[model samples]
Target: MRRLRQLAERTPAGRERYVDLLRALAIVMVVLGHWGITVIGYDRAGRPTGHSALGDLPWAWPLTWVAQVMPVFFLVGGYANAASLTARRSRGGDATGWLIDRSARLVRPTTALLVVLVVGAAVAHLRGADPTEIRTVVWFATIPLWFLVAYLVVVPLTPPMYALHRRFGLVVPLVLVGLVALGDLGRILGPAGLATGNYLFGWLAVHQLGFAWYDARSPTNPPRRRLPTSRRTGAVLLAVGLVVLVLLTVVGPYPVAMLNVPGARLDNAAPPSLALLAVATAQLGLILLLQAPARRWLRRSGPWQAVIAVNSVVLTVFLWHLTAAVLLIGLLDALGVLPTPRVGSAAWWAWRVPWLLALAVVLAALVAVFGPIEARTRRHGDTTARGRRRTALAVAGYAGVVAGLLLNSLTRKAAPEPLGLPTPALLAYLAGAGVLRLLRSGWGSRG
Candidate 1:
């Protein structure tokens, strides 16, 4: 802890603490939101059953607009990636090298989660656990990996996208938003296939805006030509986004909930809608409006150090949070100590405080054990034959991870047996990790 404080104090003068602060807050909100909405219970036969609380509490829909922080996550990702890429370029690094470095940070922590899930599933199957139950558990546990899959795709595209941002400024995101609108329209009137495009377009749009923000505040830019960096600009963003959000939900086909509500006729989030983009716009505005004060507050050692520590294990916390919730709840259930309340009842709401605390404790323990995998820095080999091969191996490694997660998501319930894990996905993930390990070892050659 003391070391983290010292590290924070040494932060570069040009570094924006507020960006890290936003990322930490966004991750916390997501974890808490997932914990709150997930309602797990045991059936009469003591089998576990679960669903999101949002299914029963329709009125809580509006709360999702605030709780859904994916946009902010992507926005911050853009800012951080832009800064990172720029710094790497200044040092004469190529896009491939920059990508390898960034991807390592995400994939390392993710590999730990995937490996654990595979082992746990195999162990449960060996113990004569119901395949159906095992499948459900594994699927639910891996839900958080969806973000990793999306983010991995976006990270590799950052170099080219940042270049586009430089040439066209805010037009990139604007065009992306326009595409999101078209995707939504297609979902309404055309083949359902077009809706899937939003999965990329929506997030890419928000990410592009982050580049805009970075360029707007670039220290080298002349003051006169810089984009308006005032509170007024943020206010305009807030107003326009809010107005569009209301219109989309109230007057258009979109739902007010920013998240995908079970059995909802139109999900604003499954394939992000223009409405979701509007929410993101409003969120970016709100974040900008508070940036000045947030930056000032973050200058203090205590607050900034906390942010640094959280950011250090951000991926670990996200990847393991659901597992922590499941472990805690499953243990309590097995012991007959788990509380089951009606989804929206006062009792259920009251239990949330303790539920969150218990989950946090479990998550913390998981982090303590697994977080170091993410923090451990790998040695970069010289840019020789070995280094190029290492880069190729790294790309294959990330590809395997991305493919495995994507396949897992797509085929989650495709199997007839409950206990069946996606064999192909598991193999791909393991193979990728193995290749990365070999590369890290310099392909069996001495360092």
Candidate 2:
């Protein structure tokens, strides 16, 4: 028992490597998952005609295991939120302002992107493009934005929901798991059932897991504290999580989609599923087990520091990734450079990989364009020059987004269509970038 306690309470070396590695790893999963859907065309489709051999290969679901790293994102988010709230309270900062700033950090960038997309689609229609085609293009271009809406819904609720964490401890996640099962069962049996409501409770449950991890509060259970030993608890968590995952996959209606396919009946990802909860548990255990090794690795790796440096702009990367793909595709098609989005054959997959790589490069370049705006707003600390400079840049970037949105609207003057990559999108990019920058600077400064 004493040995078990030591293992459980033993602190991983270095500062927050598990969290950072998890975040980076989660983001990588997200990118790869997206790459599969858009570039790889992998996964089973509802219809036989929808199958793509190259994309939906035998290894797809296993790949989804890596791709569904979203649960970890929420876990990290919970940890960060708890840390942020604690830090802010310590400094006597207004809770309202802290939340407002956080909300703005998400909203500002997100709004800009939406405005651009909505406006750009409208313009493409005005230019005499087919309405369905325009809509299809825009929809594909901005699919990942759904996370923004979901995150926002959960972020505001964190203050209150976190209380449940204090009371329930790790049991909160189990309760959430129960809720998902209930929700799924209801949807399966009832007439008016859809899993939409599950989105609120189910995903929030995942997010709350992070809060528990955060609020566990002690670095290591004190040697004198009579809590269950770390080794025993970890082993228990690992065993149970593995068992649950196997059981759920075998018996559950869940489809193991870490990424959305064009036509899926029940998206395990759209609202998430109990399967995801199990995956998260297994992942959390792994993270805990390897904390020491991850820390040592991060310390030794310089490139990792670069990744950490850039993670502040995670939303930026996530939001614009689709646009980058669309832009590359649009340009290639225009120049007779790239083929249409047809899924089949190794040849198609091979060609698409380079295009996806090019898409990533373009996204990086595009993100760089907004780097200045992102930098200004995300600055921390009290300084007149920094504040003034950030405020000015923020305002200008916001204005650019607005201007772009307005221009996109006007560009659609004669005929109406949804906005596309027209002027509105450009404005949205600037606006979103500027707003996130401001918040990053403001929030970071306070910390």
Candidate 3:
């Protein structure tokens, strides 16, 4: 703790401390929201089943607009990526190098989770666990990887998108918003396939705004710069987004919830409707408005240190949070202490505080065991033939991880099979991690 405080005290003078704070806060909110809404119960056969509390309480949909922090996550990702790309380029680094380095950070920590799940699932299956129960458990654990898959795609595209931002500025996000609207319309009037494009376009648009935010404060581009950090700009964004969101829900085909409801005919989030984009706009606006104050508050040593500690383990917390919830709930159930309150009932609401606390304890333990993997950094091998080959191998490894997660998201099934996990995704991820490890060990020796 003392070391962390000293580290915070040594933070670079001009760093955007607020970006880290926002990212950490977004992760916390996402974890809490997931823990709160996930209602686990037992079937007549005494197997665990889970559903979201929001499905039962439509009135709570409005709350999700605030709780859905994914926009902020991407926005911060854009800001950080722009800064990273700029720094790397100034040092004569190429996009491939930057992509490999950035992707390694995500892929490494993810490999830890995947290994545990794969081995644990195999053991459970061998022990004669119900296949349906195993499937449910594995599916719940891997569901959060969707964000990782999407963000992985967005990260590699940052180089090109940053270039586009440099050329067209705000027009990029505007066009993306237009595309989101078109996708929503296509979903309404045509096949739902058109809306799938928005899954990328919508997030890319939000990410583009991050580039805009970075450009607004660019040290190089003075004449073209526009300060989105200004309060008035934020007010305009908030007002416009809120109005559009209300109209989308009231008059358009979009649902009010920023998340998917189990049986909803139209989900704002599944394909990410313009309504969700509006919510993101409002969130970005609110975050920008709070940026100045947040920066000021973060100037203090204590708060900044907390943010630093959290950011250091952010990925660990995110990847293990759901697993923690599952394990904690399962333990409590086995001990006959877990409550099976009706979803959205008063008793369920009362249970949320304790449930979150217990989940946090479990997550903290998971982090203690696995957090070092996230913090470990290895020196790059020499860039000769051996080095280049290893780098390529590392990149392939990261790609496999992304592909596996994407497949899992699309299939929505990550169960344990007798020989392996349900989908080929886990195999891809494992293969990728293995190649990277082999390169790390053998690349320098070959040189």
lDDT of 3 by residue, 1-447 (tens): 988978887899989999999999999999999988988788888766778888898889999999988999999999899988888778776665666667657878888887788788779878987665676677788778888888887887888888888887888888998988888888989877888888889899989888877877765774333336788888888999999999988787788899878988887876678899999989877887888889999999989999999998899999999999889878988888879899877898898899888889999999999998886654353332334655567568667777877776666343445423455877887776676565544442242
Per-residue lDDT of candidate 1, residues 245-355 (tens digit): 999898988888988788887888778889999999888788879989999999899999999999989989999999998899789988888898888889998999999
Clashes of each: 4, 26, 0
- lDDT tens digits, residues 18-122, model 2? 576677667766765565555422135311111223235545755665567777888888887876776766766544445545645565556656667677766
Question: Over the full model, what C-alpha lDDT does candidate 2 score relative to the true structure?
Answer: 0.60
What lDDT, from 0 to 1, does candidate 3 have? 0.81
TM-score of 3: 0.93
Q: List the residue pairs that clash in candidate 1.
A: 131-418, 131-419, 132-418, 132-419
Q: What order do you get sorting by lDDT, best first?
A: 1, 3, 2
Model 2 regions more than 4 Å off: 1-15, 39-55, 122-126, 192-194, 217-236, 261-264, 301-304, 340-344, 379-417, 420-447
lDDT of 2 at 51: 26
Ranking of all candidate structures by their TM-score, best first = 1, 3, 2
Q: Output the better candidate (2/3) by lDDT.
A: 3
List the candidate 3 regions with Cα displacement exceeding 4 Å: 219-227, 378-395, 412-416, 435-447
